[model samples]
Target chain A: MELYDLELSGNCYKVRLLAALAGIDLTLKPVDFLAGDHKRSPVIDLNPWGELPVLVDGGTVLRDSQAILVYLASAYAGHAWWPDAPAAQGDVMQWLSVASNEIHYGPNSARLVDKFGYDLDKATTLQISERILGLIDQHLQSNEWLAMGRPTIAECAVYPYIAVAGEGGIDLTPYQNINQWMARIKALPGYISMPGVA
Target chain B: MELYDLELSGNCYKVRLLAALAGIDLTLKPVDFLAGDHKRSPVIDLNPWGELPVLVDGGTVLRDSQAILVYLASAYAGHAWWPDAPAAQGDVMQWLSVASNEIHYGPNSARLVDKFGYDLDKATTLQISERILGLIDQHLQSNEWLAMGRPTIAECAVYPYIAVAGEGGIDLTPYQNINQWMARIKALPGYISMPGVA
Candidate 1:
């Protein structure tokens, strides 16, 4: 199995982090966004969207970070991280959807823009991030993880961008419960810090 | 179970569509955004974000339409609509995430702006809807359903919005495959249309 990875991507980080936690060995094949590798024809042939952290196993290819997380959890483990329970599964999916839509759109994009200079509305993005973070913080007030009382795919997808969001000029000190949850996720066994872009 | 619903909301429509298809009995509790219901203290006390279609089953309340889909499928049908196969699960999630993030953000929001008279950048919203419809056409080319090889949660969550997107002034003439897929899903047993807003 091969993972087409980007060191700075939170979604890609999701695949790498889960792989580390679940003990799945995959050759990390770096796709150079600096060289516009994902935008090139060859990579576009694999995924038309030209997105990063694509996973290729045997003859199959998968794109999108949340999709890759599901693939990793389902293919590698015995449904522990993904969970098979319906109500629990719903809770898990809710968190993943929030990560994909709100957090990624707001905080993740804001962080990227602050560091990398992507064109996005700054004030609105910050406001969006604040609302989402507040929701997460409220959820974490009693729950140990993001969803279903277990550290499921939701945490895997949402944690990275959120943990590093302060670097985007957004303050995290206000979100006490979320801060504690971030610490808890970081302290988990087999935890790997996201690769920093120098 | 009580569903905090808004008839005009595609997100709310998804929960209703799934509950009908799966035979899950739910009471639809209306929340009027125009009436400033969500901004008031009571609904926010349940969901601080004040989003619609919150599924309250016993003491557990689940938000997010995609989350609700997975929850209904899990609680009622186990892993049937969500699927359990790793590679298949990846397919299911990819479409599910797209429904929540892309379809909802693109076409759904565009429709809202045009039909609901919400202030927005009309040109950008139209462009986004076109891009999403194009992507949906591409996906429907080889697959019969939106996610996986079967009628998974992806189709259930997105079909309503995509089908009625024309109401929001998005021309559907270009998306032949999508039109065909929508027809096929409706032809399925237990399929139910959302209640008319009039």
Candidate 2:
């Protein structure tokens, strides 16, 4: 399997994190995101959205990190990371939506602005970050993991952006439960680190 | 099964559309969105996010329309709506993320601003809408359905917003393929309509 990735992107790191945890071997095809390489050939050819973390496994090509997680976990990993049950898939999916929507707009966008100098509303990103972080913190207060009562791809989908929220100039100090959850994820065997994620 | 719904919400309509198409029975528990009922006890108790289209199925409670569609299709609707294979699930999931992220921030947010008078960046919403709409149109140009080579929950997840894009002040006239795709979805068995869609 070939993964067209960006070293600093939380989205890309999330996929890599899942692969490492699930023991799935992948050849990392690092894209030169800083040089507008993602918008050009090979990458753009695979994904018209011109996004990083495009996975090409045999004949299957997928974009979007959440979708890639679904593919990788289901195909290569096993049911533990991506379950077969409908309700369980739905349970894991809620956080996948969170990762795709809230985390993307909140901490991810904030990092894009602060780290990559992308033109985005910093205040709005911070506001969104605070709201979503609060919700996740509260959710974590009662649950040991994000979903399925055990480690699943939900952790893989959500943990990267949060681990690197400091790069976005967003503070994670107040989110105690979230902090503990991050520690739990870090302590997991086969967990790997990327540029921004510790 | 119960759905905490709002008649005018595309998110809610997506779930209803899936139920109708899949023959899944749901007791409509319409929330008075205008009166801020969604933020109150019952709705908020089920989904702390205070979002519309919350589903409660006995032991299972799911929020996010995309997640609900996953549950309904996988549990009751069968493999035709939501497939069993990994690559197929990933294929369907690509658009699910679109429904959750791009569609939510794009046309959905635009509608929120224009129709519901929410204080959101209309310009940004339109920009996001244009980009995503163009991408979907382009994808539809080559493919018949969004995924799995036939109608699936992707249509339910995507159609409602595009059907009512006019309410968001988004002109869909340029996207001929999207219009055609919408027509096909409407022609599906057990198709239902919401306000501003027709």
Each model's TM-score? 0.92, 0.99
lDDT: worst 10-residue window of model 2 chain B: B189-198
Candidate 2 local distance difference test against the native = 0.93
For model 1, state the Cα shift of residue B87 in Å: 2.1
- Candidate 1's DockQ: 0.73
lDDT of model 1 at position B42: 63
**Which segments of candidate 1 are over 4 A away from where they belong?**
A195-198, B40-42, B78-80, B195-198
lDDT for model 1 comes to 0.80
Query: Which candidate's DockQ is highest?
Result: 2
Question: Residues A3-74, candidate 2, lDDT per residue (tens digit)?
Answer: 999888888998999999999999999999889999999899999999989999999999999999999999
C-alpha lDDT (0 to 100) for residue B123 of candidate 2: 92
The RMSD (Cα, Å) of candidate 2 is 0.8
Alpha carbon deviation, residue B140, candidate 2 (Å) = 0.6
All candidates' chain B TM-scores are 0.92, 0.98
lDDT of 1 by residue, A12-82 (tens): 88888888888889899888898999988667877777888788999778988898888888788778788
DockQ of each model against the real complex? 0.73, 0.89
| Alpha-carbon RMSD of each model | 2.4, 0.8
Residue B39, candidate 1: C-alpha displacement in angstroms: 3.9
- Model 2 DockQ vs. reference: 0.89
* Least well predicted 10-residue stretch by lDDT in candidate 2 chain A: A189-198
lDDT of 2 at B88: 96
